[model samples]
Target: MTDRRGVVAKRAEDLVSGVPYVRGWNRARRSAGALADQLVLLGLDSDFPGLLADVNVFGDGLVHLGTIGPEAAELLANLIAAGLEAEQHDTATEASSAMRREAPAA
Candidate 1:
């Protein structure tokens, strides 16, 4: 299997480059919001002030993740992983719903 961190890093890179102009900015904002929510949920908001600041400043636009320090980049990678896992879980749940069966004779 592929390394999860590498996968998340690749995903982040794709999110940063997959689109252009307004659409890309919007996509970055949505991802930033999800990451920020995850940070707060994990109570790590204070641990990565720089990341939070960058998120707040560039959330409505695009962010240059390539220039962030190593610590911030690591935190971002973790957040991206969590987000991806959650998305997968949600997708699985939705797909599983189609396979649900009703109670038999009761």
Candidate 2:
């Protein structure tokens, strides 16, 4: 069962009828989001702010997985769609980056 926030939705296949099961952009996006949330839970967000952003930035490319030359993009998008946190990672990263300063290299 999915929550009102759509944080936990039924598996994609259950939502679609008579559709062949395919691991695509949608799935990836969801996965990415979920991964983001998991990272937050694990406190990884505090240490690696760019982790989620990279996933989201790459996830955008997933939207066109099946088209010519779109396989890679699709893969990324799918990752984003599968996870909720992954989708919001870019914004979160930007916000955090603005609040943080880089350390001087030794």
Candidate 3:
């Protein structure tokens, strides 16, 4: 399909709908603000971040995903959405936790 958003959303649906372990995909969420912040941290030179900034995910910050191109973007969004759908990740929380855990205590 030529519609980028549709393709992306569909891929995400596929992930959340596949595999026995994916039952957790039903409870994902992401705040548009947190998404924007992550996009900056990721440093990807794509419009995906801007697109995410406009998304209204109600501040959950992981329920949605995006990227620079149609094909690749769809793939990434799905991977993330999959983890989200499966309740295997809270990207922002996970990232921060990992950083904290890995950081050396001064």
Give the candidate number with the greatest lDDT.
1
Error of 1 at 82 (Å): 0.7
Instruction: Report the lDDT of model 2 for residue 25.
Output: 46
* TM-score winner: 1
TM-score of each: 0.39, 0.25, 0.28
Tens digit of per-residue lDDT, candidate 3, span 3-96: 4333222333223222332332332323555555665676643546444322111211124444367865765687689878766556667888
Query: How would you encode candidate 2's per-residue C-alpha lDDT over 4-102 as one tens digit per residue?
Result: 533343334233544433444456567656756765775544433333211122222122112323543454466568676765897799878876756
Estimate every model's Cα lDDT from 0 to 1.
Answer: 0.54, 0.46, 0.47
Sort all candidates by TM-score, best to worst.
1, 3, 2
Per-residue alpha-carbon lDDT of candidate 1 for residues 1-75, written as tens digits (9 for 90 to 100) = 334322222222223433344554576667767866776897766655544212222123444334455776687
Which of candidates 1 and 2 reaches a greater lDDT? Answer: 1
TM-score of 1: 0.39
TM-score of 2: 0.25
